[model samples]
Target chain A: MGIGPVAAQLEALLFVAAEPLPLPRLSAAVGLPERQVRTALVELAAHLEAGGHGIALSEIAGGFQLLTRPEHAAVVAALQAPRSAPLSKAALETLAIVAFRQPVTRATIEELRGVQSEGALATLVDRGLVAEAGRADSPGRPFLYATTRQFLEHCGLRSLEELASLANLPPAVTQVQPLPGWRTPARGAAGPEAATPDA
Target chain B: MGSDDRGGGVPEKGACQAPEPGLESVWSGLDAGTLAPDDVRVEALVGQQREVAADLEDATAAVVQLSRVLEAKARALLPTPVAPEAEGGEPGAEPDADDADLAERVAAYQAFAEAAALLRSYEESRALRFGRPQPESKTRRPAPSPAGAVSLEDLLTALSQVWERARPRTRDVTRERLTVGQVVARLRTRLSRLGSIEFEELFPSDADRFEVVVTFLAVLELVRLGEARAQQPHPFQALRLAWSGPEAESR
Candidate 1:
């Protein structure tokens, strides 16, 4: 019931967890009330900060997680193997658009880039950076995509609200201009424009 | 060819008469009432018979070519008859005899298919070269769309249905009980080779919660036995399993 033991238990659970741990799961695991767990989390964060530990406790994606401090990221990368290939420029741009204008359809992303972006969109989805938020109520019921929790973790942000303002983005990304020469790889001859709304 | 070269026709029948050069004259002769309907019908039959003969000749040539290809394939499939080697040679000198046989079989089939394809393509190319004018690649106009063209939305809907059909039909299978010992042996073997692996990677993607619990128990068992060590480098990270054998300890 003490804060010290609860904090130790929270730290162990967080260390072994593959994803961020929510308050409910943490409380259930420790067999303590949610209020006690919250206090312990604060205690643990303070303890880690005071002790100058490489790992820091942070709230991310609506859950508590232990993540390596930004200062130690370089050393950690040197130790850990690369998880996967870095996202391409196109994929990153698409991710940024989704993060900002979320619940947005593929058509909107293409309009922003001025190029066909199905490939980049698919890559982001595959990497778990973006996910289907839902279908648009509009014609054809196109799938609307948004940044996922993994995206926040990847970007080292706590939530969508913490995202860098759109003003920071380059003018090319914010403006709409259809690219003439660039073409979709799979079906270049028949672009997205060729698709018509279903009757 | 001239009517004379085409051979003499029956004099009684006007259509069969060797009276003119060119098919136009023959048609004109019919239209002018110089040739009777029966004579024209007889002439048409003769023309059809000649075409049939030419087609038959081509078909026979194709049959012969196919037969030769089959014969070669049959010969290749049969095991080669090896003669006795000189006394100095070892009997089992060929270590990869089975592999070699498999490779030969694969290569033989590949070569057979390739040779047949190449022959057909070569024939087609020659016909194209002599029979018609080559198409201008750059100047070629795009083909007109067929009437009632399906939109991509329809195509995607159809594809979704096809994909739905192509999916493996899930059957209601009874859950099998996974034992801790089984997972321990499996984990130990993997750890011995990999030296270290992430805990999340221990189980398959589709592993059930029961299986995961059993596997976690097995991991604890290995740790208790000093066979493996589990550590998490950072919070929210997967537990890393490292082999704690003597060599690993020294390293």
Candidate 2:
């Protein structure tokens, strides 16, 4: 049959939304319970898919938004605009590390790659793939970085769960856990569990 | 000293300007024909010549000494054992010629490597035109991390930052607080029962830090408006507050 009034309202609201709209906000606006609104979003996503519409609903960036299908990228490119140039090699590697080990800090990345990654981190953040999640609880309050939903979209992964395990890399990669300069990756001179002077 | 030696020696400015008394007398004798003696004039001229020759000898020795010192210094300044290769290159080239060459070679190699990679990428991408425009997704690049010359202080700062971010954020859940108006009303009610009350009594045991602060402020405001009187028994003592009479209120 036709789309229900609640589902139709959700579609219209999401279409007009510039940012992702959470279920609670959508439910509040539609005067329905959050569970009902969530079910409606599910049915709405499926209905759009069944109808073979160019636009589809996807939950991203902690909320739901309408996006053009991947098959329509070339068509949308014609309608919208060309994508920007790709990130540099340094940026890609940094992004991979961030995507795999999210809520990470630049220091930790530097220790792992045996390099300073401020510039790469900044680039990934600018591209909207990696973002500042929060400040670490340690001194200087360095920002903790996490992969954005845009990161998954960029990688063509549905979620972080789909990220290929970095476990395949040397046992050393996982051993480089969080700490001061976390000096184990490059400077594997010291044992991974070596204590910091302050500790 | 010979009389002819005067002409051989370089003349001194002071000697030229002012002749010696004996020489002047000799010249005057010659000019005025008073002494009428050519021998005296010859002797005086010989004496002056002798003096000038001695001064010239001393000056020449000084010049030789100064020349020797300057030559020694110049020898010391010359880059000893200058590399033949450096000398053959452009005159006054940078001392570290090898470093400069290495830098140039590195830059050229980097350019060539980048161009080669681009050519390969272009060929690879041309085949998969329909694929998503995700750049460099599968092709892993070597980590271009620097010499990881991180200092201990920097590492510690970074470590602390990591630890701090990982620390659980104490999400302070705030509760409803009594406003100044509410505190004032409550204080007034409390004071009505007891004509005077201790300042500490305003804060009930259940009162949180915020409530205590608000209650204290409310008490100060009441006293400021002359609505109440707060008196301390002595310095560093608990303050007692009472209702201000009409006189205190008028003030």
Candidate 3:
């Protein structure tokens, strides 16, 4: 195929891809040389940048992907508002572990929670709530996890201490009173019909 | 009472009796009026007990005083330095440029010190597990023997042979060689990463001395020979000398 057709195809593939695509994989899919694919990607990225659409191609985690410019994050967040749910209980628990036991391994979280937490961990990572800090020195060298700055912003904390203090209640109490809004009914307040007997 | 005096003391009625064999009988024979005049032993025992009590009280007082003095001295010795605060209501405000720069330098130094300490401990532990090599001076080079002992020239030839054997059998190969300029470049790059030179450690023998000119020059020479590489990941980080050989690529 000519370079023009190949570049068009590459752009189309990137636009619809849910995750970043590696150059090798993209080359294989498009049946083009790796060098040619890279050149095309560079050209495409520049074209997008100059277009002023607030979307740019980025290299992350060894792959190329399109991402919204950070300056447009507020607008994107507003558009995504109704689709989002309040933080799940499991997510909160995982976040707590990440915040306090930061630079901790996945095994440590499993040990503390007494259950498999892979799904919750992945979810937190996907949401940018946590990140891979580094690898531990032990055998197999598992990746250490830590809460990201987004997590701090979400929790309304200027620092990790504020988050840690959430778990630092005096030992005398067996149960803690939930924060004021946390105790509200999972569903919106009972409907008026439920409060009154049916006619 | 009627007194019947016969000579000096017409043997007072009780005294006239023979003294008893034991203390009880002797006490019974003695008049109660005369006993009080001979109570010297009781007074001596009481005085001894008083002296012992006073000594014990003095020792305890001395111990308490010593403890207080020691505590005060300890407090004076290591008083926590008060952190200078910016005159404002904002807590944890961004530090001024000078303070920020100093803190960065200090943090870098602390990290380097910690890493060096860890490396030293690891080396010590490894040495303990595996016996250390004897001093180089103790091992003497063998004298060359005809057709028996290898001479220095022969040794060099053998080393070259080994190197030739190890060379990769591929075209378009990149031969990594170290040069003085390369070493200088690496050092400059590494120094940029390092927080600052630890002048004290670099020149412990001379306090007034600041820079490490000669030692650094020697390091550059070593790096030029491919014996060492300067490794530093970030600014304000410590420079590390690492051995880079063919085997190191695997690591």
What TM-score, computed on C-alpha atoms, does each candidate reach? 0.37, 0.36, 0.25
- Can you give the lDDT of residue B19 in candidate 1? 43
For model 3, residues B122-196, the per-residue Cα lDDT tens digits are 223222221112234422332222112234666899999999889578779666454445545555444344523
lDDT of 1: 0.57
lDDT of 2 by residue, A8-28 (tens): 999999877754565667879
Would you list the clashing residue pairs of candidate 1?
none
**Model 1, chain A: how large is the TM-score?**
0.75
Runs in model 3 lying further than 4 Å from the true structure: A1-3, A82-199, B1-251
- Going through the candidates in order, what is the number of backbone clashes in each? 0, 9, 0
Question: Cα deviation of B202 in candidate 3 (Å)?
Answer: 94
Off by over 4 Å in 2: A82-84, A132-143, A148-199, B1-251
In candidate 2, how many Å is residue B215 off?
Answer: 59
True contacts kept of each: 0.00, 0.01, 0.00
Estimate, for each residue in B75-161, the C-alpha lDDT of model 1 and write its tens digit. Answer: 445665564564898654544465465434433322222322332332232222111121454114222111113434557899999
lDDT of 1 at B86: 42
Candidate 2 on B12-111: residue-level lDDT in tens? 4456633433332432333344433322434344545456433443333223323332333344356554444554576445555653454343333223
C-alpha RMSD over true interface residues, each candidate? 27.4, 18.6, 31.8
lDDT of each: 0.57, 0.54, 0.46
If both were scored by TM-score, which would come out higher, candidate 1 or candidate 2? 1
